[model samples]
Target: MLLKFSRNGRTTKALSCLLSEGFKRNARPQQAANLLRPSYLLFSPDISFLRRPSLLVKRVVCWLSVNYQISSNSWSDPMDTNEASSCLVEQLAVDPERQSSSPACPNDGDEKESVFKGLGILDRFLAVWIFLAMAIGIILANFVPNAGPALQEGTFVRVSVPIAVGLLLMMYPVLCKVQYETLHRLLRTRRLWIQIAFSILLNWIISPFFMLALAWAFLPDEPELRQGLILVGIARCIAMVLIWTGLADGDGDYCAILVAVNSLLQMVLFAPLGVFFIQVISGDSVSFEYAMAAKSVAVFLGIPLGAAILTRFTVRGLASERWYDQVFLKWIGPWSLIGLLFTILVLFASQGRQVVHQIVSVVRVAAPLIVYFIIIFFATLFICYRLGFGYKLATTQSFTAASNNFELAIAAAIATFGANSDQALAATVGPLIEVPALLGLVYAVKLVAKRLGWKD
Candidate 1:
């Protein structure tokens, strides 16, 4: 018989009373052992054991060994039913007291406390740092004009050199945290395939068209801004989505896989999609350099991913897995945030002049972008939630859908239109809007998850 444990004081007391009566009638330890079987012990839903099944088994074994004075080696020893009944009854009489005193299992509160308090001060206040970085970047850009030019001076594959470095630093640690060895298992699952199909549908088909409609509706008179918005729509995110996913406590492995797929697709689809959306649909002739887009993908994603893989394998080879996970990961983890802040500073500084001079235009452009982000993010989040994709994967799907590859967008705009053109300015505005918007969504996702009881 499967006996379930509910989180109710009366039910627990009744169960204890029933167990006492059964023990008085000389119930065997074998029956007690069967009751404690990992498969049979149906705990309250809120317990930590529900999240970690192995932990459940370990705790059960530990409880039996400690409370019943059973040796681990003799756990399988068969006792004569008649001889062991009195001892079993005595042990069973105090079973409730033993369980209440046992420290073998963690409760829901302990689990939540550990998970929530694990983050350091930097992680806890990430939004404040990002906002401060933006303000500092703009101040530096306006006060020190040379800073912008110097930061933008050298370009590696159409990305500014400093930005390239920042992207690598930002992505490397996050990618390293992904369990790449487990990716094959995820790839074999139907759920992952479903997620990929949904991502492709939302990102390529639905999102681009939605942004086009919004662009037209909002900026009817501004052709350059409209074209820029369309370009932003076509270039799906490959970078920084990982950071947002990590911040939101989403599935990093799955997010990395989606980012990889998007990068590959961006190289193939971006140029043609740009032509179709901008030239054909909007009647604006814009030349998209396919090579530039390809180069940007290679620089932004390829380098960091390759480095992360190498680092992961090499460290695992030299040291133990525990050392790599506990020591090495902690060492390198903070750099991702450092890289993020530096990237934000440089990004806003580079575009600060345009942001200041064209404050009114930035606001107008920002309105639709903000709407697009919030709409796409929450819509995808709810759809994934209702589809039963749980919180982690659902958050991954939402952020991936909402984020735009602004690097690709900016490079494409500049190569197609002049650097000083409205299209370039609009493209530059993508990060300005996306940074805070998505950061806010990270917090919003947590709140929604809590209120709805969404589990990992």
Candidate 2:
């Protein structure tokens, strides 16, 4: 009704009442009023979330999980802690009471879940498993050396199995962590390419010669010793370099790009370089066919990598840093180490006797690898100071060059010459000294960095 009031104040009061009546009949008015309502009046975020059509389904599902978990009898049941932890995973992170009634959604519980997973994976001992596997391989090589005969006819698993698996481990986890967007963003910096070029030069060009030189000093005219040193050089470092650089605060984006590029390039060139190094250093004929076969088998690297890519899609939003932390990193984190341990157990079962038999060979190979580390580590620092590469980048480049891809070398050794080969045995020793030695360097670099008035 169109109504007029006698007083100005009374007219305003009448219009307010009339508008309130109209709001009760209209959805637009009702929604607007809901927004205008005070915090104490309603849950604001809930309303906003409700308006987001895409999130509606997830919210509903999360809502159900939260309610069910909060009310379920399952939570009270007795079981081993591991079993209980697995069960908790099913409880989607959606706390109703904790949910803000505000327009923005609270994603705390979701984030917590992901962090739980990611950290679990990171905390694992995948390398330990691999290390133990090497020890096992040595034992088998010495003990049940007969098994090597069964695969003597040469099949993919014989050649490619370990290489492929190691490659997969080497490749996949790194790929899983890689964000194409990050790489695209990282490409803007010419410094990253500079670091990469520097890393590659040290890794391929200079590192091999140094290893050869060290081997020459320690073991000239010793084919076994020289060949072993060459393998270490050809493989180069994939893991430990990142660790040292990470400690030194090298740019992670640049480091990541470097790892990806290095891994790919190494795969392509390792065989040829390995062949060349053996020929030049040993002046002996080696098997190109056998090396190719080993490379063929080395394709096992695709597994974890394939799984990682699939997982990104299957578990959708968890790739984001927040969700990754909240959801997946912890549980899968340890699988690599676990896988490595299991692999070691198998290798020990398979190659235990061989390693024991060739204990002397293992000892002999260490001289060069150790010397390689010392030389590169110091040289990198010197170069950094001279070229003004800074401690962070220099330290990173040094460590990457300092470490060798032992897993690849070991697998290639086994694939090419058979599991019981002395060269393969030498390759396995790489990780034995690498992890501990590199850690020591990390501390040492920091100490030296402090002395130099560098704040890393």
Candidate 3:
């Protein structure tokens, strides 16, 4: 059944069931009274509705958000969660608004604040806690200089041990945030591979040459500085990329795929790229792949991800989501910060003596990283817009492609070249700049969308 009405000679249709039997029936008289008042307030369009995407995208996003997103608010709390879920499910079941056409959907504007509107620049900056940890890692490694490797050649627990611990701490809230099944669904997304292409092209095909040129332009004589740019350019920063994408109101399902694929690809290809880059720029090619492969297993390619998967299985259905949020995420967010601080202290203990020597080098590397980031940022933004993608998708594409995979980069860098290698230093610095830079980019994307009057 349908209720058809005409306004200004244009006709609109609403589901008859909604008008006859649900929330509207209870409030029909009250709603009619407001319509009779003839005041514009009763009829004003929701400005937010302008920014929302086509009905189809919203439906898919709503489904994913309901079933998978980690709830972070009072409305999602235990006291009313079942009822909320039921209501959302009911609205979705009807799908009163078809995606292809503009219609007034019952599901629209129900939340007090859209999640995208809730996040600000500072939160995105905080997402880069790992990047800050990495910077401290470099400072400690360069100046303090630990007693040489006890376990393997060039290993820096003497410097990096604390950084690793801080990284583990940093992973807590993040791990808590992850939903493995949600990630799986995202993997099935057809858009995932396309977005991956954007990132790979940006990081490997485009960014490297830019860095190579920048290194020649500014630090032409220094092979160390040149090597650093190559290392940083090759590896991508996985965790932080998702954080920015989420902040930009991008589809979380797509962002999840970005995380998993980048993690795997970095292990397989990052070493080869690092060697090629170092050989190309520094003209001193060593056996870069064999050693880098080992570090990949120890750091991200193998252990941490495997551990995350195992933890998911062990905890499956052990407790309600409400309990998990209250007990787990609440605890992990703060502890992750502690893990970061402690890791900095340990890294300082190992690498602090050399920190003074690396000061100039960090400054040198920042110039190219910043330029490459800005160029890619707007470039992706332009292409995504031209392709007619929504702000959410465009923003995600821009950031995912713009940022580096620092974890893989740093691991590959150290494995291929000692922590002191200018190349290794470059990878460490990518996150430091990327964290703050992406925050600024997030704000820029939001503001630009607002200015262009782009929506849907």
The best candidate by lDDT is 1
| Among all candidates shown, the one with the greatest TM-score | 1
Task: Give the alpha carbon lDDT tens digit for every residue of 401-445 in model 1.
Answer: 999999889878877886678898899889889998998998889
Between candidates 1 and 2, the lDDT winner: 1
lDDT of 2 by residue, 159-187 (tens): 43443343455445444554544576667
The superposed Cα distance between candidate 2 and the true structure at residue 244, in angstroms, equals 6.1
**Comparison by TM-score, 1 against 2, better one:** 1
- Model 3 root-mean-square deviation: 11.6
lDDT of 2 at 161: 47
TM-score of each: 0.77, 0.60, 0.63
Q: When superposed on Cα atoms, how far off is each prediction in RMSD?
A: 10.6, 16.3, 11.6
Poorest 10 consecutive residues of model 2 by lDDT? Answer: 84-93
Stretches of model 1 off by over 4 angstroms after superposition = 1-116
Residue ranges of candidate 3 with Cα displaced over 4 Å: 1-159, 182-189, 280-282, 312-316, 325-327, 334-359, 453-456
Residue 245, model 3: lDDT of 73
